[model samples]
Target: MPFSLSIIAEAWPTFEAGLITTAIFCSVASVLGLVLAVPIALAQFSRSWPWRVSAKVLVEIVRDTPFLVQVFVIYFVFPATGIPMSSTVAGILALTIHGAVYFSESIRGAILSVPKGQVDAARAAGMSYPLTMRRIVFPQMMGYVLPPIGNQIVGLIKDSAVLSIISVPELSMAFQNVLGTTFAAPEAFVAVAVLYWLLTSAVTLVMSRLEQLTPTHRSTQEMTSLLAKADR
Candidate 1:
């Protein structure tokens, strides 16, 4: 079948709105996920058993289940229990909560990757626990966390399509809507896929630049080695 450019052009407005909504959901979820992740990660690594166990349980429960089930629980089950949320709100909430679990694991791993000597050195310098974590550990952890965090963000962008099942009007929903009206399935889906590719590609590019700008341990070690040699 011959492909017609006019179909894409005509569907642009609907797709644009869907893209906007998807972006908004992702932005809000990313920020909220980060906020939720930091505390859970810290708790997971806590000296206290209760805190660690609680955090671990939460993470496991979310990770082991399918996201679709989680969405249903949030949208349908919650409403049956007296908490009603709009489709968009439910989609964002489910995505944020689910993403938080995965992001928290990344953070915990990053924190663990920090050298043991660094923590001991900070403590020896009389730095309080919070101060040490804030200044020394967190900075180092970022270098480890960023790459995986970028991957999660890309995953979340793609996963947003699942929200269409709940009637969230995301990019996939827009494509489906256009297909329903025009019966141009191929054109609509191709356009939507391109939009998704653009969004994810933009995220990957920005994150790659950020990773380059952020100093890693390898660079720090090289700098330190150079300084030591200069003293000879």
Candidate 2:
């Protein structure tokens, strides 16, 4: 049969369910990734060699290996070690760990981009490390980090499709189910593609808005200038 919107309409429920599932799980995973990444990123600066080395190893392994293999190991292999998890949970865990390593690197780079002098001044002025990071480093780092974080969020959503291999009812799996039933390859795929585009575009727009709202270099400079005068 020729391509038809009717086939897509008939499959809209499955597509909608899959889209919702994708949105929910990916949102959880992304937030967790950012939270976990901060500690891992900071660990790279730790004076302890073991902490630094371990964090570096985690980042290298995840960044170097294929994500598909990671998912397979989590879903298929872990059960044999008595770590059984539902596919949804497994998918979330995989995405969380994957995004965390990449996001940590982005955060680490952003932290490095903030001039070391500011940190030194913070230390000289009796500021503790946490205080320095909070007042001196984090505000400035946001401006540099948001763009890459946005890219990672988009990549995370796309990567969620891979979870369909484990029967995690996501958009790609929705497409598969619909295609299996109706065999409307063109129509099913076109609809899924449009949905994915819309989802990623919305994330990009939000990130852009956040980038605008975040403090600029001038503001950070002013803060540092005031701090310097106080130290004098």
Give candidates' CA RMSD values in order: 3.0, 4.7
Candidate 1: list runs displaced more than 4 Å. Answer: 217-232
Local accuracy by lDDT, each model = 0.90, 0.93
lDDT of 1 by residue, 1-232 (tens): 7788799999899999999999999989999999999999999779999999999999989998889899988999888888878898899999999889889989999998887788899999999989999988887777789999999999999988999999998898999999999898789878998999999998899889988887665436656898999998
Q: Where does candidate 2 clash, by residue pair?
A: none
Clashes of each: 0, 0
Q: Once model 2 is optimally superposed onto the true structure by TM-score, how far is the C-alpha of residue 224 displaced, in angstroms?
A: 14
- Candidate 2 lDDT over residue span 179-220, tens digit each: 899988999989999999989999999999999999776446
User: Could you tell me how far off, in angstroms, the CA of residue 231 lies in candidate 1 after the best superposition?
Assistant: 18
lDDT score for residue 186 of model 1: 81
- In terms of lDDT, the poorest run of 10 residues in model 2 is 215-224
Query: What lDDT, from 0 to 1, does candidate 2 have?
Result: 0.93
